[model samples]
Each structure stands twice: as C-alpha cells, then as structure tokens.
Target: MSPDTAPSAARVDPKLLRIAFILVLGTFMATVDATIVSVGIDTLAGEFGASVAEIQWVSTAYLLAVVAAVPASGWLADRFGGRRTWLAAVGVFLLGSALCALAWSATSLIVFRVVQGLGGGLLPATGQALLARIAGPDRTGRVISIVAVVPLLSPVLGPLVGGAILGTASWPWLFLVNLPIGLVAMLLARRHVPAVPPSERRTAFDLRGAALLSPGLAVLVFGLTEVSHGRTLPAAAGVSAGLAMLAGFAVHGLRTRRTPLVDPRLFAQPPFGAAALALLVLGASVFGTMFLLPLYFQTGRGLSAGEAGLLLAPQGLGAAAGSVLVNRTIDKVAPRALVVTGIVLILVGTVPFTQLGHRPTDALIASALVVRGVGMAMVSAPVMNIVYSRIEPAHLPRAAGALNLLNTVGGSIGTAALAVVLQNRLTARGPDIAQAFADTFWWVLGLCLLAAAGATRLPRTHVGKS
Candidate 1:
C-alpha cells in the first residue's frame, strides 16, 4: 500500500507490526545514547584529569547537536525516502560511535559525541513518522506505546548500563557498545522497512526557516546550560535572542508558501498542541530529573556508579510494567484519564523524595520510583501517541520532528534550571547534599503539577476522519 494514503489504525497488519518492531531497535539505541554517558562523566573526568563541570560539556554538546539535527529530519525524509534517510542516519551514528570510542582526549570525545547526537536525533523522529504512516490515528496509542518502550526505559537503564560498563570495562566501551546493536538494527531496517515512493507534488523546502529554527533551539539550550554555571546576564541575552529567532521562524512558517521546517498550524490543533505541551512538561519533570538522580546517588550518598545505577533500576522496571499495562488497556482508557492519573501518581511518588533525609533506605527510594515510573509511562506514551492521531499521513514527518524537538528542548531547560538550583544550594555553609537533592526534587514535582493542569486541555478523543 502506498503510505501517502494511510491505513486504518483498527486494522494494523502483520507487516506493519513487524516493521514497527524493527524501527524500535533504532529508537532504543538513540534514546540510550542520550543518557548512557551520564554515569561516565565522573570516570571521564578522572581519566582526563578534568573537573565534573568540565566533563558535563560531553552531555551538553550531544544535546545541542540533537537540537540542531532534529529539525532537519523532516526535510531529509521528504527529500530522501524514509528507508534511505534512515539507513544513512544509522550509518552516521555508527561512524560517530566508532570515533567516540577511539577519542584520545576529552575535547575529542566531546566533539565526537556531538557527531553522535546529530545522527541520533534522526532516529526517533524518522521512526515515529514510519509507524504513524502505517498504523494511522485509530491505533496510534498501541503502536506508540510499543515504540515508546525504549525511551521510557533508557533514561533509567542507561546509567545502570553505563555504570556496569564503567565498572567492568574502560569508559570508551560505552560508545563501543553501540557498534553491534546499530549494525543489527540497520540490517533489519534495510530488509523490513517499507519504502514509500516520493510524492509527485513537491513542497519546496524552506532553507531560511530551517536555518533559523535549528540554531535558535541550540542557542536556547546553550543558554540554559550556562544558567547552571551562574552566567545570568549572558544566559539571559542568549535566551532572549533565541526566543526572538524562534518567534521569527514561527511567523515565517505561517506566512511561507513553501514547506517550512515545522508547520505553525499544528499548534492550533488540540491534539497536537495540548499534547505537545503536556510532553514538554513531562520531559522536564521525568526525563530532566533523570539527569540528576544518578548524581544524587553517587555524589550525595557516595554510592559507587554501579550501585547508583542499580538503585535506579526499579524505576525502569516499573515503567516497562506500566507500558505493558497500557498496551493492554489503551482502547478502554481515555487519553486524558491516563495523563491526569499518571500525574497524580507522579506527584504522590515525588513527595517521598522531597522528604528523603541523609541515608534514606533503598527500599523507600525504590518504591517511590516505581510509582513515579508507572506515572511517567502513562504520561509520555499516550500524550505522544495523541499527537499522531491529530496529524494527516503526509504531515507525520513534520509532526514527529516538531514533537521530538519540543520534548528535548523542554528537557534541556528542566535539567539546566533544576541543576542550577541544586548547585546554588550546594554552596551553602556546610551544605547537606541529601537536602539539596530533595529541594531540587520539589521542583520536579512542581513541573509535574503544571503538566497535570495542561492535560485537561487535550481532546477527549481523536478527531473524526474527514
């Protein structure tokens, strides 16, 4: 079937399911790469004789590259076929991984990580476009839940996986590990992923819009990163400029006859607009907190890297469980119900973190994380799927890019803001590390509350077909 006319979601065929499963491997790898190096920051600092702040650039650079590359995915997929574009992206990622593994210095490693993120950015957006084209709006939640499995698990498991590698192997092995998995995924995609013939009608690409969108997001994220270092004035200037550029792009997108980088009209639709906002906050609260948790275990509690990772594994396990449960109940539960209930659970679970004193028991932390995991799974998967339900088949790639971009941008902002707050408190007279972490966790809870409020704005159901 030509993907230009999307299939009915209620009748997802065996071939589509198989193709979705294949694409998820790439998604898993991309999401894992986002957080895998986080636990290795300390190890990299030790090996390179750098400080913790210096090594953080490794993560910041990758995130910045992702912000830059994501807007280009839609254009790439439209200009090249999904199959060819996807293959090229995975190849680029593998090449970057190889470079990162062989990096001789801290600067070299950080630069290679940027290369890796540029490649990694395309995977999830392209994969979403692929799945959305085949499954259509009716069963978007089910397929999206499957596609979402890795992202939910990766943040929790990444640190653990990285910790294990750092414990047993050199820090380089973190990048080295992507080699085999990426190859296998590339092979599967080549064999099974459907090739959609390019459309006869052309929407000319907007080079000016693309130029403005990518760097604006990158500069915005950079400004947030600067906030962590107490660079208030410079960060403010960068942020203001970034906002102006983005605002300009939005205006240009609305006025353009050409195919702009992202459609400004998407925000007018309830499913895409409200759900996107919900995801933005979820990213900040859940994914953003992911960056800080391992640091809390290792720095605040003085646990070994491996131990910190293991301590966090229950959250991932709970998230996996929640995804499975949602898979079974997706048709029965309303998207709004799932989002609001999830937010409530998340808020309740986070209450424990704010009260965690020095040396709180592992069982307590793990239990709370489990509940938060289930809540996050409910929020992230369904909200994302809801966006697809609103978009047309032809617009799936653009929608995917825009949604992924918003989520990542929110996550970078959340991580930076919370980190800044945490760092500032840590400099107090004889600072209590546990208390500092707890204080920052309260910020996460506050974000979740905002997300819960936003959930009310989402549609009660997908719009009926025209």
Candidate 2:
C-alpha cells in the first residue's frame, strides 16, 4: 500500500455515492442538532418551565452521550455489519428527535437527547471506516475530503437552520426536520452501504475495560462542564477522579491482552501517537474558540443570539473552503508543514479578536471569522489524512474511533477549561465582560501556538495523493 501504488480516484458505484451522500446527510443532521439547540435554549426554558442551567443539560447530556458511545463504534461495526449499524443509528436518531420534539418537560428532553447522542456518535467514526473500506487503499484522501465538509460547516448551518425554524415555526420543528432526512438516509443506506463480514477471531467484549473508560470520560467531561457554572472545586475533583479511572483502564487494557476496548498498541507507532496529540490540542483550540465566539458577540458587543450566529457562519464557510483546498494539496505538502501553517493561520486570526473594542462591528467579526475558518479548513483535513495514512487499512475502524473519541473529549475539556478561565477573569474584573472575553481570546491564541508546536511532531511527508 505504497503512496505511489495507490489508486488516484475511488471506483465508487453510482449507488454507493448516493448512499455516501445519505450518510453524510445523517452526519450533518446529528451535528447540526447538537449546535442548533443552543440558539433555542431560551425558548426551550420558557416552554418547559425550567431554569437556564437546567436547560443547559440538554446540550450537556447530548455531548456526554456522544463521548460515552464513541469508543463502541468500531466494536459495533464489527459485531453487526456497517450497513446494519448505520441504519440502526439513523433510526435511533430519528426516533430520539421525534421524542425530543414532543417532550413535555426538560427531563424528558434530556433523556431523548441522550438517545440522539448515542446514535450521532456512531456516524463520524463508522462513516469514516466505511468510506475507507469502500475506497480501498487508493483514493482515501479524496473521499475523506468530501466527507470532511459535513462536520466542518455544520456549526455554521446549525444556527441558521435553527433560527429559521424558530422564527417561522416552533422549537419542535428543529427535531422534526430530521424525520424526512433520516427516512431518506435509512432507505439509501440499506441499498448501497456494503457490509463487512464479521471477523471470526472470537475476541471477548472487554466489558471491564469499557466500564472503566466510558465512566471515566463522562466524569472528566462533567467536571469541565461544571466550571462554567462557578463550581471550581467539584469540577477539579471530578476531573481528577476521571484521570485516575482512565489510568486504571489503561492498566486493565494492558493486562488483559485478549481484546481491550481500545488497542494500546496503536500508540506505539510514532505517527499515530503524534497525530492523536495533534487531535487533542486541535480539538481544545477549535471547539474552545467556538464556545467563546458567541459569548463574545452577545455579552461583549451586545448582539442578539441570532446575530451572533449569523456572524459565525463565515467561519464555517471559510472552513469549508479550506477543507477543499487542503484535501487537494495534502498529498503534495508535508503533513508537518501543512499542520504548522494551519495552526499559525489560526493564531493570526485570533489576533484581531484580542484587539476588539467595546463595540465591534459585524463586518470586523466576519472578517476575523473568515480568517479563523481558513485556518480551520487548512488544519482539519490534513490532520485526518496524516492520521489515517499512517495506519494499516485493517486498523482503520478502530483507529478512527479512537481518534474521534479523543476529539470529543478534547472539545469537552477545551470548552470547559476556557469557560472556567473566562468565568474567573470576568468575576475578578467585574462589569468588564469585554475585557474578560479579550483576555480569553489571548489564552486561545496561546493554545493555538501550542497546537502549532504539536503539529511539528507529525511525520514530515506528503499525504493523500498518489
């Protein structure tokens, strides 16, 4: 499977393309649902007669479910077939969406959201694995570049779609929108998604390892989420406990040797290990910035939620553009060079935000967002290509799942840590929300720098292209 010998383009059937598009649509649905709810939080709170803090759990619960279920994706795909698993996931997501829309109370909505998250979590990793398998050794980069757009631009699309639904209809429509799309995806998936025959290796389920890892991640993310609400000590304790459990899981994984939930051997490869670190930092920086941008607009600049969301769209647009460009050039440029360049652009983009005044215009924010988006576009596809290229095809599913797990956890940690930093600074500064946000932007800038340093460790080779 040398680069020179790989296929230039995937020999995908016309039917498979339709199926891939359906899968991508489902992926988009899940991602958009996660971010869209943020825009409707006020409405949801009023409707359910709940406090904003309680309503926040809708988002938190969804994220937690995603983290919990991500590691199981590879296993599920192997146990069932990819097509069967994907269809089941979409069906569950649709059902959850319907339940969420019809919820009589916040508590019920949270429960439904957990179901949604479980289903959504599988799309990213499983879909990647399917694409890799279908495309074979050749054309992995090209196919992945196309798939990358679904998640990359989802944040931008989510708010706009949510805002439109909120304005014309009710919040229920937000979930209802998934029904038609999910039905279409389910039908197409059954027809076109190829099934991988189950392995006859007879490995055990590693239930103990799963129990240790899943709850550990949950506690860790829970601790981080608590920081935004001014609960520092509890948050710190939760994170500590999570780390201890994760360490225990690692020991269990090593000792058992039959079949760990995650294969520890993957990290033994230098490129794979480096790529994982890059994902962690990149997740922290990227998602953390996303969490901060809206607050900066709403609190610092006095923009409404809708306005802030519209402004964020440019970042998504820019990222989409960058995904296309990077995917094309990844095979030509060294992975380290591409990663470092992307990170540097992201850092430079944050520079304008650090200099914001009390009343920044939409134009200024849009410009900066576009720059940040470009940086994102530059980084994401290349980083993914590098990670997958280093691994053997047989391990793609597991590796992709592990990578995605790190990504989700990284985002949770990054968002929570930045939230804590912003909260502490705001409390200390008092009535200077703008300054506090600016200070946090500076911190995000620093993280981007750190990510740049991490990028250097990636293998110095041209990725993707044959």
State which candidate has the highest lDDT. 1
TM-score of 1: 0.94
- Residue 408's C-alpha lDDT in candidate 1? 78
lDDT of 1 by residue, 1-466 (tens): 6665665646556777788888888888888888889878878999888899888889888889988998988877777767787788899899999999998888998999899999999988888887777676776778787678677788877887887788799988999999999899888887878786444556677889988998898888888778788889978987888888999999999998887888888877777788888888887887767777778887877888778878888888878888887787666777788888888988987888887555668898899889988888888788877777766677777788888887877887888889888887677624588888888888888898888878999767544622
| Regions of model 1 farther than 4 Å from truth | 4-14, 49-51, 232-234, 358-360, 428-430, 462-466
State every prediction's TM-score relative to the real structure.
0.94, 0.94
Candidate 2 ranges with C-alpha deviation above 4 Å: 1-19, 358-361, 463-466
Worst 10 residues of 1 by lDDT: 457-466
lDDT of 2 at 36: 84
On the 0 to 100 scale, the lDDT of residue 127 in model 1 is: 85
